[model samples]
Target: MMNRILLSVSGVLLLLVGTATLLQPHAFFATEGITLGNDPGLLSEIRAPGGLLIGCAIAILLGAFRQSMTQTPLILSAIVYGSFGLSRLLSMGLDGLPSSSLIAAAVVELAIGGLCVVFLLRLKPV
Candidate 1:
């Protein structure tokens, strides 16, 4: 269930973002569909990773919550995604207004991370 959720969400996000960046880097930057690191060189480097990252994220999500699969990915998502969300929450202090995309991104990330965190934290040792 959780795996499906992540795969559906992330898979779509990855494919859309990857294609968007590829088709028009300037347009994406203009509308803030994606934001790269501050420096142009850094942004270029960052862009390089997006291509396969989204696909990988989808795969990981599917693996994490398989009915009888390993727990490591779930554990990782709780930490990594949750921290990304926590950072977004903190970013609210940085500016009074953030872009709509950022807000939406933050919301989704928090949802994914929050679910992972709650489930993982609630687990008990056998």
Candidate 2:
């Protein structure tokens, strides 16, 4: 149903992004028009969140398959994506517009967060 679709899409997207960011931080930033110079410290910071994202992605996928376990991941999805969207909004307010890719990402994050909220509302606790 809609819940499965949301989880599947979010999980796959997060998994791919997490893996890419973890494995190739420089390349990932390059795509975003940012040069992640050869700073070990900066790379470490990026990789840290990337690992968490990978874990979240796995949880989402598991929830998608195990209907009884969907609640937690759906809640997580709402929190994480909502936070991302809000952060992006804050950044825009403070620093002005970023690249097109970043703006697009913000839009997607907001939309996904909204979808999570809607799905969670519709879902009945087991």
Candidate 3:
């Protein structure tokens, strides 16, 4: 119930972000405070992550609907979000605090990851 809603909402957010990245990498990068220099490989690099994230978003949305049949995708979602948050934490330790927008992103990543973990725990044996 609540878990499913949470998963679906998170999935929707991921889907929107992923889609935006795929369609408008420059705009996405700008919002993230990144500047894609005039490197030949830059677009390729951007598109690669876009494709991967789109795939992940799809899997997460599917998992939201089929929570009983497939916990694996939800598990992967937790891992993905956790990895992003943990990596940001590591960066904070190594590079000091980032700008406020990036800090906000880090917080959102951590909160979403934590929510996913809590939902996983509440899942009953079926």
Candidate 4:
């Protein structure tokens, strides 16, 4: 179903991105034209969220195949994506424009998050 597809896609993306961010912070941010320094503290800070993302990805992916556990993941998806997208927009306003790739990421995040919300709304109560 559409819900499964959405969760699968989002979860996979989160997993990949989180893995890359956790393992190769420099290379991953480089795609966004960011140059990370060789500071251990900074790298740790950057990597922490990556781990969280991976955790969320696992949960979201699980929800895809579990009919009785749909609602929680939908809520998580909405919050995660919506917050990321909204935060990016906020950054654009506060820090000015970033790379085109980042802008595209924001848009995609918003779209995915919005879709999660739509699917959540359509779910029938048990």
Best by TM-score: 4
Q: Per-residue lDDT tens digits of candidate 3, residues 1-75?
A: 776776787788778877887788888889868888667587887778777778888888887788564466667
Residue 24, candidate 4: Cα error in Å is: 0.8
Cα lDDT of model 1 by residue, 25-88, tens digit = 5667778755554687866765665665555555555654574543555665565567767788
- Estimate the TM-score of every prediction: 0.62, 0.96, 0.87, 0.97
Measured on C-alpha atoms, candidate 4 has an lDDT of 0.94
- Which of the two candidates, 1 or 2, achieves a greater TM-score against the reference? 2
| Tens-place lDDT digits, model 4, residues 1-126 | 888999999899999999999999999998877899999999999999999999999999999999787889888988999999999999999999988889999999999999999999999976
C-alpha displacement of 43 in model 1, angstroms? 3.2
Question: What is every candidate's alpha-carbon RMSD to the true fold?
Answer: 4.1, 0.8, 1.7, 0.7
Worst 10 residues of 2 by lDDT: 117-126
lDDT of each: 0.62, 0.90, 0.79, 0.94
TM-score of 3: 0.87
Give the runs in model 3 whose Cα sits over 4 Å from its true position. Answer: none
Candidate 1 whole-model C-alpha lDDT, 0 to 1: 0.62
Which stretches in model 4 have alpha-carbon errors above 4 Å? Answer: none
Encode model 2's per-residue lDDT on 28-111: one tens digit a residue: 889878898888998899999999989999999898888888888898888888898899999999999999889999999999
